[model samples]
Target: MLRLILILFLCGLLASCQYQRPEDARVQIQEIEGQARFTIDGQVHEIKGLAGHTHLQEAHSIGANTIRTYDTTGLQSILDSAHHFGLKVVAGIWLPKSHVPWLYKNEEQRVKLSKELAVLGRKYRDHPALLSWCLGNELIFYDLMDFDFSSTYNRLLDSLRSGDPEHPVGTAFANYGHKAILNFALKIRSLDYLIINTFGRLPKLSEDMNDLDFLWSKPFLIGEFGENGPWETEWTKWGAPLEPSSSQKAEITGRRFKELPREHPNFLGALFFNWGWRHEQTDTWFNVFSKDGERSALYYALAKQYGDSPVPEIPKIKNLKIDHGTNANDFWFESNQWHEAQLEIPESLNQDSLEIRWSIRTEDWFFLKADSPPPLPDLIEYASDRQKIRFKTPGKAGPFRLYVSIHDRSGHFAAANLPFYVVQ
Candidate 1:
């Protein structure tokens, strides 16, 4: 009896020491009842997420269940923080774009990257907060047509799969055009799902997906969507894209979220374009938050759509005009000439608690090149009278934009910019 008891105790100890994968840690896509749905372990999950890594706690508070990153930098910390906030992470694994042909051609380099990715897959595969692995973000599809590039990409995907079979792997493409669809259909069969980043084209995304169903019918996520990107909007005669006011952006964001095809059989839900601060075109073009961590009108819009209880009221900015004219498309000013601009806000907002600031920045024209963001233009000072400002145009003969930022005491902000050309 003593021997039997000792044996039973030993068996229990061994069982306790045995390694077991965490429950509900596996993430994948399944076709249940002819509909593709993302599943955690065996339970279906709809991804209401943000394609950024900051403000995770705030994101969770606003009903965002997932956060997507663009690279693995600080991934462990991001995963930890996300877990702390009960948020899942769609961790991104950055890959060299097709622009770097030499990297793809060098078999040694390609092998090294694959090995590194495999290690990463093994390292974080079991994290409870991990939802999926995104291989790349908006890689140039035109260059991906090269055999070397396509093979390299597929090999990397295979490497990731070898290390983690429990999680799904995918890539993000920009604006799903026919060429992109055809290329993906023929060369990229390894992805568990596809991620498409659409801005102005978001409303028609469902139509495009249906029309190209024969070419590619896999599940997809709207990896990024928001207001029209700078590249997709109307430009001034001198070529500066007209950015919408904060109020307009909020409206657009709400409209786009509502237009998402949540009922589509292959839809896996959408992730808003930006959840944190980004200096893409202007400092405010894509950022939903300010540099000081203040929430913008975009944030309130998302919060309301995300079903935040008691959503905070968004401050309003209306009737922004330059030199008493509402049309910026035909506006041009002499170099160094003073011009007046005005905007009105709701009288309900207390003026004493609001801080209004203004400036002018050179229009960002370097979109095609992957370079450092253009230096912020010199502070063209303005005399402010509440919501009205008088500022002199820049002395240069190029496109410039006047900007206004209004901050309320409650940590909310409103921003607007008007594009104009300065002539010699």
Candidate 2:
């Protein structure tokens, strides 16, 4: 009787231990043939990712295997969605700027920040779709000339690391501030990788990497990059840049995509500037999709670069003008007059479920400043098998632009714009 009781007690203890096993697992990053790559659940993953919020289905359709978000809000839903689509995420935690010296100096603020990171780590560390923890976006960009937050930043990273050891932790810096970034990175001792957000200066990135490599031998990824930014493009007298046309942005994206993987061996992956619209300097600046969720020309361009299959080209708008104007591209129109605008599509497009959308709106120059949002463009018409647009000009006299986007069922699109004046 004594021997039987001992055997039963041991069996119950073993069952309890098996039931309490941890469900969460950590992802791995390994060096292969002198290059660093990610391993999701022990399988190597090549990251083709986009930044910002996009519909899960649309994001998956474009060959994006990953997405990067800049905040932890609604993170469970985001993680669940990514897991459903077999996508991974470089989750971000927003860090307060170092411009406020008091925040970093105060013990209360330090504890608060550390606790926030701890909560995040405990909540999401075990998620199957998590790639890494990106602590902040360009936190050191503005502080480079003023102060150093290495101690604060490092402490926060340490807090997260303590709570979660399965994933890596890193932060993003702007293209400039190399010296300050290097100084802080060297002091941390726990940083796993480097993420840099750059724009026009990307051409010289390879040289900069060699410089950084001399001091710290670490892997890096381009956190955010688009064809151009307002600061990088040509500016007008009022200190605003004349944004490049959608077609120009598309062309640049194609060329940049082809060059990223081939540029540097340490270049693990890149996240395109934006997946959705935000009113940064201009409503149309870096957004890949319009306010109403129509894919931009850049979307299709990226699709062609990302997918192995051939993609259909977006329709071209050769000229836009008031009816029978002497100039091929005359955009001036009388407000009271009815005019027909013509579009010339390229014969090269192999049409499959082709559709077009047109819209007209007042110029958005007044609300183009940072943090101010411009009004969403009012859509005019949705059409099928249409090559011409007929409409009366806006009654109120102001600058306006006519936009036309052509799309196909295969998830490809083309976009163009014509700026015009409506005279009283």
Candidate 3:
């Protein structure tokens, strides 16, 4: 009885010393998963600034349970926080020397380097926050090595497996032609997933994974992607400045329409390329959001799509006809001359929950107001941000302000003021 009492006291002491991280401020991988509705292998945007814990939390909020670090400095904090938040981490050991197929000419040097990576594996292997060990980032840049990477990958996997049997191991292959890609695949052990960097041929991304040509293999991810480098025809890639805004929408939306399906069975996860704004190189242009956070519609599209959504987002609004509410792109109604001047709602937002916000400013720039309470429109779900809103005044013909703001039941809203000329 005395021994039992002492044991209970010891148990209490251990429990008391256990760490408790903030609820909203995430801690480790296991913690955040409790709140996550689905697993998201999201790209981390500003992962460099604060310690890895802070960066990992930001990724968690956006529905990611895993992140691939660009480097190894803040790894421990990231790993710790990720574990608490139910977030997993892909530690990127980018040994640029690894890129050169024969950088380490001597067998002794190669052995030493292999040992270096093994040391890394040994250090973090048992941590609760680990997801996979990405042997190296873009090392196989179609690299011609005297000592093939297959020997090294198999070796590294052996090394990591020695330390941690709990997780899987992988290596990132830089962009490659289908034939070369397939050859590489043949060499390595089938991984939990494959990482392919195919930027120019995105539609082909799905096709590449499908194996319409070669015999099928395990699941894969577009570990790195964007429209073609500036070299590719402007005619071919999505839009302007590589259409950074539109490209994200096109990439993810296309993936959703084409490849996003939990039912697909083999698909596991994906880690998009570098998170921060890296403009030192003119060729790399896949960043979705800017350093300042001026997000494109695609950002919201991903948010709404992953969080919860009733329907796919409609194509972007374009070439609007002001008076008739009609457009080369849409048939929305627009009018003048009293209540009749109101624009008709587009059928796209019809029957869907949405929120749209837009505004019009006269040459003089005073916003109009709606005489009555706003109605929910099919186009926009929620509108906020601009200080100015447009609505129709009590009379349609008074030449009064025509500030119109509409919020549909779906929650989408658009408010804009247009300068006048009565209907033709």
Candidate 4:
């Protein structure tokens, strides 16, 4: 009798200790009536989200169902926070550009990195918030026909798969041509999908995809899309890119969102280029939010598209003009010269409820090599006013941009910048 009781207790203990899979743990792509759709645990799911780590709750509130990251830094916390907010995560794994020869040649380093990635996969595969694994972000394939690099990448993919077969794996590419697509089709057999990061070229994406269907036909995501990139915009006499004002950016956002192939059979979804502040060509280039966490016109534009009801009013900057200049971009300033600037806002907006701030920073002109953001430049101290202001240019001769941020009482703001060259 005693032995039988002990056996029963052990059986009960074993039953309780058995691992149970989390709900919706398996994510994959399925062809339903010739349409490739993403399915989470056999239920079709569409990704509507942005590509940044901050503002998870806001993203959820604005009707975003997913969040995309560029790398695994602080990933465990991000995944947990996302789950808490009922948002899914497309976890990105960082990879070096293909032009780097040493990474492919060094077998030991490759094996180490592969093992680390596999460990990450195994560790997070069961996390309920995980949607899929994006193997890399905007990695350029210099020689798609190179067998050695293909083999190395495949080994990495194999490592990830071995650790977690429940999730799908894909990679992000900068909008590439047919040769790269053909190479992906021929060599990268393990990839479940593709992610293309396009900016100015987004309008023609449908045409581009249709043209390349003969080479590759897998479902793809717009990994990054937003306003026109600095590389594709008009340049000033001093070669500075003319950045659009916040209101203009909102207009562009709406237009680009409309151009997305949401109705296409193979279109998965898109993650807007950025959801948080970033210093790229300019501090405000792709950032939807301000440094102080104020929502900009771009954010409101996206919020409306994502189903935010009763969207708040966006502050407008009719135009920012320098002294005696017809257009903001046509101005040049002398070193340390005081200039009066005029900011035009509609009379409908209550001027008393708005807070205006200004700053001057050196233009980020680096194009090829990636570098850290330059130090913050001096801020312009202005007396309380909304329409006119006086400020001095930098004391040295170089390219600089004057930035203005107007915040309303309702947590909405507008941003605009004007580029000027300082002459001695």
- For each candidate in the order shown, give its overall lDDT on alpha carbons: 0.79, 0.68, 0.43, 0.79
Clashes of 3: 64
lDDT of 1 by residue, 1-424 (tens): 8985675455334323422233444776888887788888798887788989999989988888988999999999999999999888888888777668666789999999999888988998889899998998877767433668777887888788778877888888887777666565666655778888999988788888888897568789888998899899987777777888888888888789888887789888889978998776677888899888998888878888776656576566875788788788777888888778887788787787888887777777775333324434543444446687777777778877777888988899988888888889
- List the candidates' TM-scores in order: 0.89, 0.75, 0.52, 0.88
lDDT of 4: 0.79
* Candidate 2 C-alpha lDDT tens digits along 75-165: 8999999989888899988877766576677878888879878887888877888898898887654343232465677678778877777
By TM-score, rank the candidates, best first.
Answer: 1, 4, 2, 3
Residue 351 shift from truth in candidate 4, angstroms? 1.4
Please list all clashing residue pairs in model 1, or write none if there are none.
Answer: none
Identify the runs in model 1 with alpha carbons over 4 angstroms from their true place.
Answer: 1-25, 143-145, 367-384
Q: Which one wins on TM-score?
A: 1
Compared with the true structure, what per-residue lDDT tens digits does model 4 show for residues 1-424? 8985675455334323422233454887777776777788898877787989898988987888888998999999999999999988989998887666677778997899889878988999899999988997766665644656766787888788778877888898877456566556666655788888889888788788788787567788888999888999898888889888888898899999898887778888899978988777877788888777888888778778887656666688888877846364567878888887778878888888888877677777874334324534543546667567777887889888777778888888888888888899
The C-alpha stretches of model 3 lying farther than 4 A from their native spots are 1-55, 97-104, 141-148, 189-192, 210-216, 225-265, 272-274, 280-284, 292-296, 309-424
Write out the backbone clash pairs for model 2: none
